[model samples]
Target: MRGSVRKILLVFSFVLILLGFWFSTTNAYTFIKGYMLFQTDQTHIVNSAEEPSKQHKDNLKQKKLYTIRPNKGENIGNLLIPKLNATLPIFHGTDEEELENGVGHFDKSVLPGEKDNSVLSGHRDTVFRKLGEVGKGDTLIVETSAGSFTYKIRHVRIVDKDDRTVIVPKPRATLTLSTCYPFDFIGASPERYILVADLISQKLT
Candidate 1:
């Protein structure tokens, strides 16, 4: 009876050990599976966040580069004013000679159709003699080697001739036209007649 009891005790101990081993193995498998699933989900989230950024960079790289750079005093384009039914030549520099020939483009500003302020200036007595008749809601079109850009007038102002705000940077594509104020002023005018326009459309050439 003592031997039988001892044998039963030994069998019970072995069964307990087997149960413990099985439980531990099962828990280890569950933990490993959970960890792998967590890692996969993290990887997926990271990839989702990075994909748009990568695509944005690729799109920026694929955009067309504006390569129309004209020398100072060179004819670069034409400015068409629909209200006045006029088309004027646009030159690169705002010098006296260029202004005498046609409208003068401020070299410091961006070119027409670009993503910044493009400024054009003309004499009150010549190319822009009737510019006073043009007000807000008028359309201005610029045709350059790069493309033809249409802009709609948004604001009209008469600022002092020395005001630097006329050439300030714009948030988007803009066109600024300036001429001596009082269109009938005998000589050098004291103020500038300004027309600010926003780009409406563009046709690539």
Candidate 2:
């Protein structure tokens, strides 16, 4: 009788262990799926939200954002590239290490409507990978809380590391997209890819 009871207890304990592991794995999978979905949906919402009330924050960024240079950090509003289905934190100063994950506001990169050239940089692998799919005429929107500014793609090019022309301050409202080049290269990319666009419109939302 004693031996039989011990065997029964051992079997029940073993079953409970298996059940616990199963539940843990199930919950983990569910949580990961939910998180990924949130990021994907948010990227779309910020990129495409035309509802004025939702984007009221951006309209305030223009005057509030500062002009900090390299090694200096500033929050330069938010960047939304619809073609890439990406919305990323925008920062001032294009420090390469800082740009490893989020969009780096090129220090002298033009504002939406200010000078001739404005540029924003983000990592191609995470927040801006969708940029690779962008084509001519695709819409790029930048939100400042109070409104949105839009741009239309004009051209795309891959330039050598020394091509400094693309970074020059421009005279028209232009958007320049920047990323490490030779995208397919398995090693350190030695080039840069730039997408140039012209401002088509701006509005309060």
Candidate 3:
């Protein structure tokens, strides 16, 4: 009976070890994939008008071509937060797969450099890990194939996770960056950290 009990205990220990290894492996894979996706170039965009193709071709002659027709899950642009010294790829959607790769643009919101709220989100523990270090008067820059826009941080606030007021349309062009609150939390965060900025300038490349 003693020997049988010893064998069962050993098996249980081995199973626990395997579970831990699997967990680590999965998380590592996710992080590595996300890193690679962010480093890759994104030259695509959804064209709402005929100017897209013509614009892209024209830019191509200048060796500045951008704005290819985008499919789902394509890279859109890059988001730079000077205060945090962080630059992350911005994808088209806020879904899990897209967010896993980098910061994600809310598709329902206006595009960057446009005349409405352009909302971007990321995981607090990853891309926006240093977000808390940012403050008012800082700058946020978004670079896309169409152009680069500079925003001046006007406000920073912590809101409930479900708050929709933060993303409401504004009379002036704006940029909104969001992430889960309590950056060091172990599980699903219950609050959101919001960074609101206004478009101060833009340069069409």
Per TM-score, the best of the predicted structures is 1
Considering lDDT, where higher is better, how would the candidates rank from best to worst?
A: 1, 3, 2
Per-prediction TM-score to the true structure, in the order listed: 0.84, 0.60, 0.65
Clashing pairs in 1: none
Over 28-49, each residue of candidate 3 has an lDDT whose tens digit, in order, gives 9998998777655232223345
For model 3, the stretches where C-alpha displacement exceeds 4 angstroms are: 1-70
Position 21, candidate 1: lDDT: 100
CA deviation > 4 Å runs, candidate 1? 1-10, 26-34, 56-65
lDDT of 3 at 43: 22
lDDT tens readout by residue for model 1, 54-82: 99999876235266588999999899999
Candidate 1, after superposition: displacement of residue 25 in Å? 3.7
Model 1 lDDT at residue 115: 86
Report clashes for each candidate as comma-separated counts. 0, 18, 0
Poorest 10 consecutive residues by lDDT, candidate 1 = 59-68
Model 2 has an lDDT value of 0.75
- Candidate 1 lDDT score at position 99: 99
Q: Which stretches of candidate 2 lie over 4 Å from their true place?
A: 1-71
